[model samples]
Target: MLRVGVVGVGNMGRHHARIYSELSKEGEVEFVGVADANLERAKEVASQFKTKAFGDYRELIGRVDAVSIAVPTSLHKQVALEFIENGVSVLVEKPIAESIESAQEIIRAAKKNNVTLMVGHVERFNPGVLKLKEILDENLIGKVVTLTAKRVGPLPPQIKDVGVIIDLAVHDIDVMSFLLERNVRKVYARAGSAKNPLELEDYAIIMLDFENATGVVETNWLTPHKVRTLSVVGTEGIAELNYITQKLILYNHEWVKEAKVQFKEPLRNELEHFVECVKKEEKPLVNGEEGLHALMVAIKALESANKDEAIDVEFT
Candidate 1:
């Protein structure tokens, strides 16, 4: 059995803890412990799962074979590097880190330690997205010409670590990159603090140019209602996905009509994959390199926004 530990117990962190606990009872994984900077929260979570709790993650690293780092974006490198140094595999929450330099350091550390390094780009595991990707890969949508995604929600309390681009739009950016299977050639973006008072941008719009397609992503933390939706257009058909509703609508010439499908919960599947990866010692579907690429794209978008010019993306 592979022992697993989760660091952080906030909104998303708490969800990770709960999922891990349930997966353990289902015999998919072994929950070892949970850690958080807030000792009380860690203790509370540990009590719920009947596992050990620690205020510092170091205490749990040696006891577990792998860890899920759900800490803040600014601390990703520090916390993940510690676990990697101790030869513990890690599944870190998305965006990797605030800078490419830090992301590369963590990637190098994971490679040097010969440990599995995964990024928590949970959307890719969504059933609706998975099905949609299958259709796109099969050429149901025929060569995608353009795509757009809008993710807007009310602003949460400030974390002051990263801007909205990295915090939110990175999800769509990564998803688009995965679906298109091509590097973004140029990017343009504009953003600022619209609702909350912080150094990070609270609202933003990014435009991307690809070799065969173009894409746009508008992310804001100042919307009245939570909205997460994406639309992909191609020469033959179109696909629309409502992430909040877990519904996918496709219009294809083969069907001569539109077809709709509903998706079950995606978080459960994402956690299940993590459990399987830990037990089987397999690389994750979304690895650290993918997360780094997303970060690189976001950084260039921000640079474009600041300079009021289009920025080019450099890939390795």
Candidate 2:
């Protein structure tokens, strides 16, 4: 059985632990344990999962074959490097790291250790997104013209390290790149703090220009109700996706169609794919390089917001 553990049993981390625990009962994998900086929190989660808990994440380095690191953005590199150097595969939460440099370091460490490294761009596993990808591949939308996404909600108390661009807009940025199959050529953005002001911005509107398509991402922490949706307009028709409900709708001159999709918990699908990759020694759908590119675009968006001008995106 594939042995697995999770570090940082916070909001998202706890879900990872729960999924692994359920998968363990099926005999396909073993839920080794969990670790968190907050010892009490770790103990509480471990109790729920009926597994061991550790105060230091490093304790699981040698014991588990794979680990899911859900710590804050700042600690991503530090924690990922430790486990990678110990030859443990890792599935790290989104945005990879705070900066491109740190992301590159994590990628290099995983490569040097020859371990599987996957980023938790969980939206990629959303049933609606999966179906949308297939529809695009079929050219149902014809040549894409524009993609727009809005991800807005009240400020999450747990978020403190990064702004809307990195924490929220990155999802749309990654999704846009995935659908368009091209790197961002330029980024123009405007961001500021209105409610729940911290060191980072809490509101942002980003416009991305690609080779043949354009994307707009609107994210904020001030909206009272949560909204997660995206729309794609192409030559043939327009398609809408609701991230929360996993719903897809198509609109054309002749007809309006609702695409049928089998809904599954995105986190479950993500964790399952990570485990499969570890077992088969295969590359994940969202690999280290893709993660880094997303980070680069996010960083550029921040720069564009600060400079009040469009910035050219340079990918390595």
Candidate 3:
């Protein structure tokens, strides 16, 4: 069984802990231990799950085969590199690292260690997205012509680690790249801080151009309502995905009306897939390269916003 340790017990980290605990209970993996800077919080989570707790993550590296890192963006490189250097597989929460250079270092370390390095771009596992991908693959959409996404919600101040672009909009950018399966030619964005004092943006609008079409994303933490919506316009039909409800809708002239479908919880599905990958030693759908590509586009968007000019994503 794969021995798993989770570092960080914050909001998203807590979910990772619970999922790891459940995986262990299901006999798919072993719950090695958990670490958090907040000793009390770590102890509490450990006690709840009947696992050991560590104040320092380094202490658990030798004991676990793999680790799920849910720490802040700033600490992603430090934490991931530590475990990766010791030949431990890692599932790091998304945006890979705070910058492209750091992300490259983490990727390099994992490559040198020959350990699995996956990013937690959980939306890639969403059933709705999977079904949409199926339709696209079948040419049911008749070649996607344009794409747009709106990921907005009331401020979750606890997520001050990264800006809305990295924290929220990166999902759509990643999804757009997956859906189109092409290299983006150019990106333009505008963003500003809403409340936080840091340079991190709370509201942003991004645009990406591909060979055949364009994609747009509006992400913000200032919206009054929670909305995770994506609308894809293809030559044949338009598809809408409501991420919050796991519902999908397709509109076409041939249908006479729009068709709608609902799916189960994506988070559970995502975790199940992760467990399967670990058990099978298989490459995950959203691997480090995919995550890095998304980050590259996001960083360009940030640069575009800062310079007030369209920036081209330079692929390495």
Runs in model 2 lying further than 4 Å from the true structure: none
TM-score comparison, 2 vs 3, better candidate:
2
In the range 1-316, model 3's lDDT, one tens digit per residue, is 8899999998888888888888889998899999999989999999998899999999898899888899999999999999999988898899899899999999899888888888988888788888888878888778899999999988776787778998888899888889888877899999998775675798999999988889999999888999999999999999988877767778888773333445666656766776677667788888888888898899899999999999988775
Clashing pairs in 1: none
Candidate 3 residues lying further than 4 Å off, grouped into runs, are 256-262
Q: What does each candidate score in C-alpha RMSD?
A: 1.6, 0.7, 1.6
Residue 234's lDDT in candidate 3: 91
Count of backbone clashes, every candidate in sequence: 0, 0, 0
Please, what are the lDDT tens digits per residue for candidate 2 over residues 68-187?
Answer: 999999999999999999999999999899999999999999999999999999998898999999999999978899999999999989988998889989899999999989999999
Q: In candidate 1, which residue ranges exceed 4 Å CA deviation?
A: 252-262
**Deviation of model 1 at 311, angstroms:** 0.4
Global local distance difference test of model 3: 0.87
C-alpha local distance difference test of each model: 0.86, 0.94, 0.87
State the RMSD for candidate 2.
0.7
Deviation (Å) of 77 in candidate 3: 0.6
